[model samples]
Target: MGRPILGLRSTLKSLTRRDIKSYMSRRYSAESVFITATGNVNHTKLVRALSDSIGKIKRSGKAQVIKAPVATRSVKLVKRDLEQVHLCMGVPVPSMTDRKRFELYLINTMLGSGMSSKLFQEVREKRGLAYSVYSYLNLCKDAGSLVVYAGTSKESFGEVLTVVLNEFEKLATELTIEQLNHTKDQLKGGIVLALETTDARMMKIAKDEIYFGKSMPIKSLIKEIDRVKLEDVRKSIENYLSPDNITLAAIGGGMKKRDLPSVLK
Candidate 1:
């Protein structure tokens, strides 16, 4: 459900205790549970503590299942009187377990994840078309997306879009081995740096458990990343970043629906 808005009452009034109990009974089953902890901790004590509390929750025979939402290849434009135009373009990718997962991560880092990335240098530093530009991969259990976002003045929106699209198109054909290695090193450094923190390690452990059913050792993950080749990156780009698969979303004033096709093309 969407967040309830203040001063605007929802169609449904306050929920009764029975409604909440029924919903929890269906959703919070043992099959849907996971517990993760980091730092100085006793597993047995933690389990016991949890058992004393959440263990009382009755398990439903099975947890509720929901279908994954389909990815759409459409453009949506939201007009508003704003100083800058915001644009997001995305294309679907495989799930986290796919062999191309690491390659996709490398692709994002090379494309825009940091100050040294292509989008950052070209779109912001050189052209000054946008103040913020980045690309990221969102991976889920059954689906994923590679999304690029940029915010620019309304006058520069079209130019920024063209530059973003050109960058994506280049990935399919012009990615270089040197660039690939550089990005891989960058990603490896990032992984090592992230693991150095307790909170980051905790999140990594939780995500690995939720997605892969086990925690992967940092060395093992690094090995997989190191094994990624230039060919692998190009193949992933060709398979996933095709213009035909793209979806665009824009918000700002002075945007015409007709402009989307040309920009995306």
Candidate 2:
């Protein structure tokens, strides 16, 4: 109840119909809801039907006070008997609305999206340290982070983490013109490919509206991705990927927090 906002299994099991209804009554409101659609749809008819159904619900008038999530740098080591150790290293980054997010996407693609990525090439192709290694961006409305995940033997866990951390440190200055262009192309291709389906298009529409309060055309987004210069990427890395913003977490046997090298910065 103190920190677990979603509550645990025991707390969930204690919920009754009345409790759920009460919570919903306080949280669900017309002002907080959004409806979006894609494909052949009659907008007027859809709105009419929705108004007849959803309009009946009253507004709760509970002013939503959203706060940005705080990112604290620390290492969390969870002990467990397993064949391999799993780790997730993360650093704070700007929210989705930030202009730098596009560059961050390019950075993520360059760092871990494919076999050609730096992490895959160094960790799996060259050193044989991990079977799975990748980095991704997790951005919400007001806060976000870039996270890397890898799994390896306990003996190799420290080495893998060190390699990943070194990559993070090198990213600000080590990016090349060729790498930047290639990563830009990769990111653009992925974005275009993901919008081929109706559902994907629908989700994109919803997100664009939610984040920007307007519909952003794919061409505009592609153009923005294209406009991201090398300097922009380096600036974003300098701003967000510093040592003080990084957090490392691991789950495995034998490895403890003390065993981790103080290599972050």
Candidate 3:
């Protein structure tokens, strides 16, 4: 299991006032902060106001930066009393800085990012094996993962798993020009729509600053998406979607932990 983001209650209770103050001083330093304001905001006035308020903050010692744990391939199953079986399979991929990151994003969109994506169409619309199925990309500073999730009845678990795995395996060889273009268009559209909101734009700028140490223009990202070719997508699939590197987690009432491996196979 992963460590809770807010820490355990016992751990939180052990923290002293000095510890909290020290942690806040280290983590929320001026160097680590990025502020973005949208709309008709005056840059000069905003900076003056920010400087007046932020200048009072004292810098403590540098925060200790811990590396993310390396991901390994494994399957874990947790049985519960539930009506639907939920499963998630993940594969580690390159970090956000990698040039291949865009290709992975496109692959995720084509695979299961939307209603018209491969997983949704095949697993829910066509086969009726699952009510919900989608793929997502989790890109961090130093590591990333492409994950697929589905929920289905206990009886349909095997079929759903088989379909999901087959779809991933087939991505290594079977991408069409039409699929590539369509997914690109979809991604571009989503980006444009997302940036229409001031909050989204602020979030984008903050993330870009944190990750790239600079703001990346939306046009540049769109151009990169457009530049991804069919072969690039295929290569990303072959490299990141290897069967040997896959990890599976499942939660279901009727399913037994011992039956997971055979179902996955």
Candidate 4:
């Protein structure tokens, strides 16, 4: 919430209780100062659109109110005392525009993407090393990171963690050209779909400007990702992925720090 969505219309900003005093004095009250715009708007459409829908649902003269929890990064957490843990890891990434940034991303997707990925195929589908395993990329202002996550039973957690580390090290040294290219194609496919509509274009422009201060053409960005070489990806894995730099947010009854340090190695 440090920076709000830019697509929101300024009028939709509600009056505080203090500002309500001024609102009552003015002809254009808070209710009247509502609008809709195209760029960056999503839930922000509440002012122009949703208020009516919400009003219709409240058919009676009485009112009911419900409040949702605040923003949270954790999507799901349960306490079953299951003999396993789920771990989320993130690393530092390069700039958004850098073609090489996608190198790590491609590797991650291929290594963890569903039935076709190395992690899912080896860990979950084949050997039952884990119930869930995957990899992803997160990009921010000047840096981003490749991340991998897994849910493993406590008995298998340490062993599966070692297997994950082996997979990472293998990418740096013995990964095949075919596997690397497949991941690159996966990255390309993902980037292409991102600009599927005018709304997407506008959102990209707004977010890019907010993050990088300059808007990169979608085509140009795609070309950069397409140009990446295997060597670039290898360097990213070796240089960026490390035991000391890795941060794992883990949840489970069986989680133990003693068994985790070597995976980032």
Best by TM-score: 3
Error at 172, model 3, angstroms:
2.2
**Residue-wise lDDT of candidate 3 within 90-132, one digit each (tens)?**
9999888888899998999889998888899999999999988
What digit string (tens of lDDT, one per residue) describes model 1 on residues 138-163? 88888889999999987887788788
lDDT of 4 by residue, 79-118 (tens): 4576678776655556565666567567677677657888
Candidate 4 clashing pairs?
Answer: 7-39, 83-154, 93-144
Overall lDDT per candidate, in order of appearance:
0.85, 0.85, 0.86, 0.65
Q: What is the lDDT for 69 in model 4?
A: 23
TM-score of 2: 0.91
lDDT of 2 by residue, 9-55 (tens): 99899999999888788778777677889899999999999999998
The C-alpha RMSD of each candidate to the native structure, in angstroms, is 2.9, 2.5, 2.0, 11.0
> Which portions of model 3 miss their true places by more than 4 Å?
261-265
* Clash tally, candidates in order: 0, 0, 0, 3
Better of 3 and 4 by TM-score: 3
Residue pairs in candidate 3 whose N, alpha carbon or C atoms collide under 3 angstroms: none
Give the number of colliding residue pairs in candidate 1: 0
> Compared to the true structure, candidate 4 yields what TM-score?
0.63
RMSD of 4: 11.0
